[model samples]
Structure formats: structure tokens, C-alpha cells
Target: MEKGQRMKIVTRTRAGTITGLMVVVLVLAGLALPAVAPRSLIQDLFFILTMLSLAQVWNLLAGYGGLVSVGQQAFVGIGAYAMFAMVILFGWDPVPAVLVGGVAAVILAVPTAFFAFRLQGAYFAIGTWVIAEVTRLLVAQWKALGGGTGTSLPREATSDIMGVELIRTLFDVREAAARDILAYWLALILTVCIIGGIYWLLKNRLGLALAAVRDNTEAARSVGIDTTRLKWAVFLIAAFATGLIGALIYVQTARISPDAAFSLTDWTAYVIFIVVIGGIGTLEGPIIGVIVFFVLQSALSDYGAWYLLTLGLLAIAVMLFAPKGLWGLIAARTGLRLFPVQRRLVGHDINGGK
Candidate 1:
């Protein structure tokens, strides 16, 4: 091969190898880090997973299906509150309780999708916000759960596990460390499972339909696709995943309240920010964005308001200059992917008439 062709081959090979290595490393690190890392590190990893999951769900809807919703928090709050009700009131195990909360969120999404579907574009956004606010108010006023103030799992509250203990004292560093690590692993597993499920879904016919619907609903429908039904499916799936993440958050933080649980500022902001920065419409983008966001947050948290201001500015910059997002930009330019969800061209068709 000529020098230029040889260099091209070398570049492609290196990129492909590095991409595979990166994915392997990520999966291994997620599975093993909590078991060996210090408590603080494990906690941080858990937070990253939570953020990543949020970004992925948002990407699945808005990025892939063209569903921009400002009220995903409705499912988040539902997941948290449902977990509380199941574990505390019904005396269910935390693990099963989390799944129950996820199911409840999925169930609730039916009605939410029904009503919210009536709106379009900005109207849809407003409808979602209204629905979230109403849900928040209803949960807050229900005194049995904690009303507006909040709800708490008692200090001595124990799940069905006979010998397992709840960590109550931060001063007990060892105990806190143990609990944090366990929680970290739980979050990691949940994140991996959700991402894997998404990957499997996207590789199927539904995934192609979702992509078509996102790119151009009118064109998609003209081709005999059921655009409305596809949107509803995306909505329900997003709600289910968001709710499951909420339960994971509650389990790790060991607390939940209507206000904090349903807070849209960070939840909405992070989801959008992550998907935008990482790359919308690509599964890899959200995960990458989560890592970048968490690192920035941890590094600049001491700066307080400045940290948030920095994030806002960064997000705006990403949107304006790189709408495909950071991951998307890289994928477009470099043609590298950790998961390889789509195929790209490096060479033309061998059988071309030309």
C-alpha cells in the first residue's frame, strides 16, 4: 500500500482497538470498583451511574424519538414515593421494592402519556410540567407519607433481610463505607442492566421505527408507521427507566421528600446537559457525558454558584457549536464508538456500477 493508504489503515485499526478496550475497561471498572474502592469513590461512582441513566433515558426520548419533556420528574418522584410505600408501608424488601416502584412508574405513564399526547411541541412541554407539578402537589398533601415536608425511613427501619443493618451514623466511617459500597454496586448493576436493555431494544425493529419517528414523524407516518403509538412507547419506556433510577437514588441517599424527590432543576438540567454534551441519539453519548459532568461537578463544587454557572455556559456552548453533542462530534469526525450501535462508511460499495 502507498504511504497514505497505509496510514489510513493504521488509524482505523488503532481507533477500533481503542474503542473496544475502552468499553471493556468501563464494564470491568463498574463491576469491580465498588468491591475494592474507598467508600467516597464508590459513592461518587454511584452518582455518576444515576446521572448517566437519566441522560440515556432523555436521549432515548428527545434525542431519538423527538419527545422533549420537562416533566420526567413525575416518574422520578413516583419511583421514590412508590419505593417508600412498598418498603415502609407494605414491608417489602428494598430490592423488590425498587422493581415495584419501577412497575408503578410504568403504570402511571399510561395515563400521563394519554393526556400529554394531546399536546405538541411547546404545548407538550407545558403539559408535562403541569402534570409533574400536580403529581408533586398530590404527593405532598397526602399526610400519610409525610405530606409537603417529606418522608423518611426510620433510623431503625430494616428491610426483610433478617441480619442486614441500616447505616445511620456518618461518624461510623467503617459502617458508612460498607453501606456506600453496597449501594454503589446496586446502582452500577441497575445502570448496566438498563443500558443493556436499551441496546437490545434499539437493535430490533422497534429501534429503527423510533429512529424514523424521531427524524421526521410526518415522513415516518407517510410510510405507514404508527407514529403516535411509537411516541407512546418511548414515553412509557422513559418513565419506567426514570422511575427505577429514582428508586436507586432513594436507596443510596436513604431519604426522599416530595420537593427534593420531584425537583426538576437538576434532574432536568443534568439529563439535558448530559445528553447534549455526550451526544444525543447515541447511547454512548449519555454515558460519556455523565462522567464528564460528574468530574466537573466534583472538581468545582467548592465554587458553588460558579460551578452551576460554568455548567450552564458549557451546555449552551455545546448546543450552539456541537448540536450532535461531544460524542456525536467525535463519532462524526473520528468514526469511533465504544458500543458500535451504528455502521459508518470508510469505503464505498465494492459492487458499485461506477
Candidate 2:
């Protein structure tokens, strides 16, 4: 074998091992979170997982699919409200209701996609925001589902049997802690699975086609790729993921309101901040962005607006100095990948074995 070929083989092997270990470690950490974390810590971790999922879904749509949407809060609100309505009006279990919320969001996404797809570029952004506003108004006027005042999950709604002291006693301390931990692990696992699912998609033929369309939609269509269908498919998938995360958010918080549910700032600003800071296009970027976001949020929890201002300044710096983002910068320099999406030959086999 040629020297170059041998070196290439070694490099690929090393990269594969590194990638495998990174995933394994992360998975183990997530699984073990509940057992180790206290009740208070578990809540915060749940919030972080929620943000991570949001950042990831947004990254998938904007970074890879080239559909820069600014109104994912539409799905978030839909999911939250769906969960609320189910628990309040229909007497459904919150666990199942959460999944139902996601399904409902996807249902809404279909018509919304039809309208949003009619617009292109910045117009689509505006269309999404407008659609969200309209939906919020409609929900607000509909008094059946809390109306303008919004709705809350009944305290007793989640129990298997209403006001069962035995159940409460069983779940009061460690049992409740265990349940919270389980929820955290569930979110974490789903987040990792979703990321892996997206990675697999991008590594496949459809992903290549999406990339082609993103590179040049006209050219992709000329080559027989259905750009419209592709966009809608991605839009729906993104909606599903966003909706699921939204449900997760409410599940942890145990409450919902239109102001909180439909707030674009939570989904848009935070996801954008996470994606931009982490590196928009790469698989690991959102993860890094979430870490940075939480770090700042934790360190500056007391400083309030100043912390936000600092984030803004940092984003500006990333945009100016590292347009590709933090993950992009690190990937460019160190060639390290926690979840590598691409593989390339760095060398070839030599005439004789190394």
C-alpha cells in the first residue's frame, strides 16, 4: 500500500473512534442524570435539554436546509396550548397529552406550510410571524380554552387517582425526585436521538439533495429535484421536533399561557443565539451553543439585562470574527468532531505497508 493510503486509513480509524466515544459518553451522562441530580438541579437540567432541542431543530432547518424561519414559536405555542386544553377540557393524562400536542402542531404546520411556502426569503419570515400572531388572537378569543386569560394545568390533573395520599406519600420525596429524573433522562435521550436522526438524514441521499437545493434552488430544480416538496418536508419535520420540545417544556414547567407559549423571543432569539455561537452549519454547533448559553445564563442569572447585553455583544463578535460560529471556528482549527457528518480521505496507502 502507498504511504498516503496507509495514513488515510489511520486517520479515518482515529476519527471513528473519537466520534464513537463522544456519543457513548454523552449517552451515559444523560442516562445517569436523574440518579445523581437533586430535585432543584433536575429542573434546571430539564430546561437546558429543552433549549438544546430547540437549538438543534432550528439549526436543522436554517443551517442545513437553508430555510431561515423566525417563528417556530408558533409550534411551541400550539404544543403548549394543546397540552393545556387536553388536561383541562378532556381529562387526559399529561404524558400522552404531550405527544398529542406534537401531533397537533404538525397538523397546523401543513396549512401554515402551504401559505408560508408561497413566500420566499425574508417574506417567509414575515409570513410565519403573522401566522403566529393570527393564531394567538384566535386562541385568545376562544374562551373555551382559557381565552385571553390563558389556561393552567390543574394541580390534581396529573395524578393517577385524584387526592390519593398513599400515592402522594410514595411520590413525595425520592419518588418525585425519581420521576423528575426520569423526565430529564427522557428529554436528554430524545434530544440525542433527534440529533442523531438529523445527522443520519444529512448523511443520506435526501440530505445531499437538500444541500444541493440550499446551494442553488433553481439549479437543483433544473436537475429534477422537487424543491417545493423538499422545503415542505423539512418544514414539517422541523415543526414536529419543535412541537415535541414545546411539549417537553410545558411538561417540566407544569403551566402555560399565551404570552409564554406564543412568545417568539424564547424560540427565535435563544435558538439563534445558540446556533450562531456554536456554529450554524455543523452538527456539534448547537450543542456547543447551548452550553455557552447556559453558562452565561447561570453565571449572570442575577445581572439580568446586562447578561443579555453581554450575549448580544458576544454574538456580534462571533458574527464579525467567526461568521461560521464557535463550532465552525473550532472545527476548522482542531479538526475535532464530536458528531462528524462528513468523512474525507487525508492520505493514501503507500507502495509498501507503513
Candidate 3:
């Protein structure tokens, strides 16, 4: 080592500047999409944003928190139901109602965590599912929202949405197009918040503790990490975020049913598939996974059962060949990370892991 040389210990990625510029360009492009893109495309973007948010939330819980919950649908359904109830019974604005749903999910998470934290590993996963079923049964008893059947948001409620009229005027589109744009905008904001929040969390000290716990809970606890509190906090946070996404989804659809809202396949299975297919532990994994899943759905969904079968087969294939996921494989080969989180000491010996 030369005495005149200095070590540059850093957390910033080599690609950080380029990645930040790319993100800004993408966001600007997305916001202007309605001007050139059709309404249907806007609706599809909304779907992608909402589902992407849900997947990211799920990934944070299972991938980093080591709480592999199989019943995130519980939070989704609870949020959707709460949003509907607020609109129907209390006459709240649909937009604000979505926040109410998140709060409801947070409240639900209290008891959910109390029971779920009692179990470990696979048992915890199953326990969460059971609690979801119980929640569904209880929600099914609410007659105001059509009991077990379900109901659509009244035309008045949908038509009078906060920004729909303004969007219609600004874009010179029809009511429906305007509505889709509004939903798309909300989805965009929410997705950014979810991803950004998770990224920030992973960069902080708690993220280190979370990683330690994920590797070995006992070892983490031996080192004085409050694994229990961390798990509970993560479970509750995921529930709130997932719930908010669910409520936003139904708010745009203007429809809700217990079965559809609480469906394991739509809310939980698909999300798990997205995260697993992309990369479980990495933040960028969900983004890549959701894009791939959306592509498959768009291309093959018309084949009905074939689409489902293909997804299953592809998931199995990825597990067998590229256990870390598609993004993981590429990163391993190229040392690329769209959302880099791992910290490495690489400058020089004098860096001293500083």
C-alpha cells in the first residue's frame, strides 16, 4: 500500500447516479403517459402499480423480516371492507376512506401479531391464514355491504371522486378515462411511497438488525436485538401498507365482495409469486417480478388454465435453476443491482470497513 493513497469507504453504489437519473426520467414519462397512452393502458398501469405495491410490502415482511405470512389477504380484505363501510355508512370520500382502511388493518394487526407471533416458521404462516379465514367469516356477517354477496360503489360516489372532474377538464377525456387517470396517479404515488420507504428502511440500522434476525433469530436475540419487537413491528407495518393498497384497488374498481377481496389467490398467492419469481430478499426483485408476471398475464391470460399452469411451471423452473430469481441471476453475473442494499468494504485495506 502506498502511504500517499487514501481509502474511500462509502455506501453509495457505482451506479447510483445513473440509477437516480433513470428513475427521474421514468417517473416523468409515467406521469405524462395519459397524454399519449390510451385509457385502457392507464388502467393497466394502475393495476401494475397497485399489485407492485402489494408485492413490495409482502417482500419486506417475508424476504427481510423472515415472517413468511401466507394470509396477507386478511389485511387486503379488511382494508377494502373498511373503505367500503366508510363510504356507505359514514359518507366519507372514497379517497380518504382508503386511509381509514389502512388504519383498520393496523388495528387488526395488533391481535393478529399477538397470535401469529406465538408460532414459528411454517406454523406462523399457517396461523396467519387461519386468522384470515376468521376475519373473512366475521366480515361476511356485515349486512350493510350486501352480507356475503358484495356491492358496487354507488354512481354518486364514483362520479364525485375528488380529482375525477378536474382530470376530465384537464385531459379532455371522458368520465371513465378521467377516473382511470386519477386512479393511475394515486397508484403511482402510493407505489413510490412503498418502495421508497422500504428502501430507506433497508439503508438504516434497523435493516441490519432485520438481516441478522433473518439469518438466525436466536443469534440475533443473543446479540441483544429485539427480534420479537421487530417482528411485531414489521407484521403490523406490512398489514397497514397491504391494507392501504387493497383499499385503493377496490376504490378504483368501485366494487367489493368478501370472496373477491379476501381471495387467497388474488391478494396473497399472486404477490408471493411475484416476489419469489423476481428475487425474495432483494427490493428490486419485486419490481422485476411484477413486470414479468404482468407480461405473462397479458400474453397468456386468455388461455385461462394454461396461464396458471405456465406460472406454476415457470416458478418451479426458476427455483430449480436460479434460486435467487431472475434479477438475482443477472446481478450475480453482472454485479448489477437496481436497488442496491448490501454494504461492502471494497476501497482498500486502510478502509477498515469504515
Candidate 4:
């Protein structure tokens, strides 16, 4: 040991640096995909990117904030409906309406948190589900928005959305295909922002506080952490992001129905599956999980109920054999962390000697 030395906290690792470069390359490739890829493939990517965004938000809420909410469909539905309302009612363009959707979701989250935050553990989960159901029912009563049956976005709105013309001009594709490309690009951007933002957060002091709160609420509180505020912030942030994703999803589909918009199976359950199977607490887990999920869906979806059964069985097997998830298991065994969040202390002599 040296008498006079300096210590620095480092969170970067060799693997993470390489992974970051790889991610940049992949993103660039994704941006170029519409130029060469088929329309169906672009649509498939939109699905994957949206689902990944949802899974990441859910992971942030449940994995880091210690808030296990099963009713995230509420935000998705609200966000979609809000965007629909903007287009159908106020005649706003769908592109800007997507942002409104996020804002609307945040508005819903305020009251939702006020109620759901009072409950703990499973009760909190149930509370969220109940709220989502209630919201769905209320939205169904909005006859202006098609009541229970739902309505489709106006053709004019979809045909003339911002960026669609540019894409159509560049690719010489139809309006429908151009719209899909625009949506796909937005999804790609959203996914990257959410992942990058979460990683940055995980490397900061607030991330440490979040981990402490997730691990031991009482202990965190004992150490002067404001657990309530932290949870609130995480909840609202998740709601806004989920809402934005939701809105973007419907914009691409150009259709909105209460049942589909607020489907627990699509928005929440599938997301939970992705996070659980991939690794809930790690950023890399959702990336791995979504890929696995999409592969499984593509392969077994033709089997109807068997597809769900297979997913159920796989999830159960993973839970029993690898509770930490596939990524967690891999990281534990190989000591490989592509998204290193743990801070390490490095010491050097004040005179610059190592």
C-alpha cells in the first residue's frame, strides 16, 4: 500500500466497451435495413423493437424499483387511446400524437401510483391489474372513440404522416410500406434511447440507491434514502416510456380496440415472460430474452395453443433451474458482463505510480 494514493471508481469493462461498439454497428445496420429488407421483415422488427421497449420498462419497474406491476397494460392502452383521440378527434398528426400519448400515460400514472403505491408485494401487483381493468372499461364507454368495438386511424393521417413521404420517395414504396418503415425506424430509436438511458442510470449514484431500495427497503430508509420518491420516479418514468411505445405501436397498426389495446396477454404477460426468461435485473437480459421470445414465437406460433404451452413450460423450467434468468446464469458461469454496472475501485500512487 502507498502512503499517498488516489482511488477512482470505474464501471467500464473490456467486454462492455466491445459490446458498445458492436451495438453501434448493429444500430447502423438496423437503420439501413429498410433499404434492403423486405416489408414483412421491417414489420417484424417493429414488433420486436416495441416489445423489447415494453420489456425493458417493465424490467426497470420490477427489476430495479422493486415494483412488480402486472397491470402495465393500463399505460399502453391509455397511451394508444390518447394518440387515437388526438388523431380522430382533434385532427392532430399521428407523429406528434405519440408524444401526447406518453404525457397521457404519465397523467394516468399519477393517480395510479397514488393508489397502487399503498399496497405491497402481491397486493401491489393485483392493485395495478385492477386499475388497468377499470381503465379499459371506462375507455370502452367513450362512444366517440368507438366505444367497445374500437376504431381505426383515419387513412389520411396514416398516408400523410411525417417522414412517410421521404421514405416513400427514397425507397419508391407504397404509402403503407413507407409508413411501416417510418414506424420501424422510430421503434429502433426508442429502443436504443431506453436501453442507453437505463444503462447510464445504472452507472450513477441513483442507481445504487435504487438497488439498495430494491434489496432492502427498511435498510435503505434507515440510511436516509427516500424510498417513496424513488419508486414514484421510476413508476412515472416507466409509465411515460411504456405509453410512448404503446402509441407508436398503434400508429403503425392504424387500428385501436379496447380489448387489443389493453390486452394483458400482449402488453404485460408477454413482457413479463421476456424479462423473466431473459434475466430481470440486468440490461442484457431483456435483449437476450426478446430474441429468444421472438424465435420461439416464430417457430411455434402455428401450433396455436401448443405455442403458449411451450412458452409456459420453458418459463417454468427456467424459473426452477435458473431463477436469475438465462443471462444471469450465463454471467454467473462465464463471468462475462457486456453491460457492466458494478463499480470497481482502482488505486494509484499520488505521484502517478500504479
Whole-model lDDT values for every prediction: 0.78, 0.79, 0.89, 0.94
TM-score of each: 0.87, 0.88, 0.95, 0.97
Candidate 3, pairs of clashing residues: none
Compared with the true structure, what per-residue lDDT tens digits does model 4 show for residues 1-354? 656565777888899999999999999999999999999999999999999999999999999888999999999999999999999999999999999999999999999999999998999999999999999999999999999999999888887898889999999999999999999999999999999988888888779999888788899999999988898989999999999999999999999999999999999999999999999899989988999999999998889998888888888998999988999999999999999998878678543576
Residue-wise lDDT of candidate 2 within 51-169, one digit each (tens)? 88889899989998888888898999898788778888898877678787889889989999989888988999899889888877877886877787776667676444222334335
Put the candidates in TM-score order, highest first.
4, 3, 2, 1
Candidate 3 structure quality by residue, lDDT tens digits, 147-215: 899998888888888988888888899987888898898889899889989888887877888988888
**Leading candidate by TM-score:** 4
Backbone clash count for every predicted candidate, in the order shown: 0, 13, 0, 0
Candidate 4: the clashing residue pairs are: none
TM-score for candidate 4, please give it: 0.97
Q: Write the candidate numbers in order of decreasing lDDT.
A: 4, 3, 2, 1
- Expressed as tens digits, the lDDT of each residue in 250-339 for candidate 1 is 876777889998888867877888888888888889977888798888899999989888888999999899988888788888777666
Root mean square deviation (Cα) for candidate 2: 3.8
> Over all chains combined, what TM-score does candidate 1 have?
0.87
lDDT leader: 4
Q: Which regions in candidate 1 have their CA more than 4 angstroms from the true location? A: 1-25, 158-175, 343-354
Clashes, model 1: 0
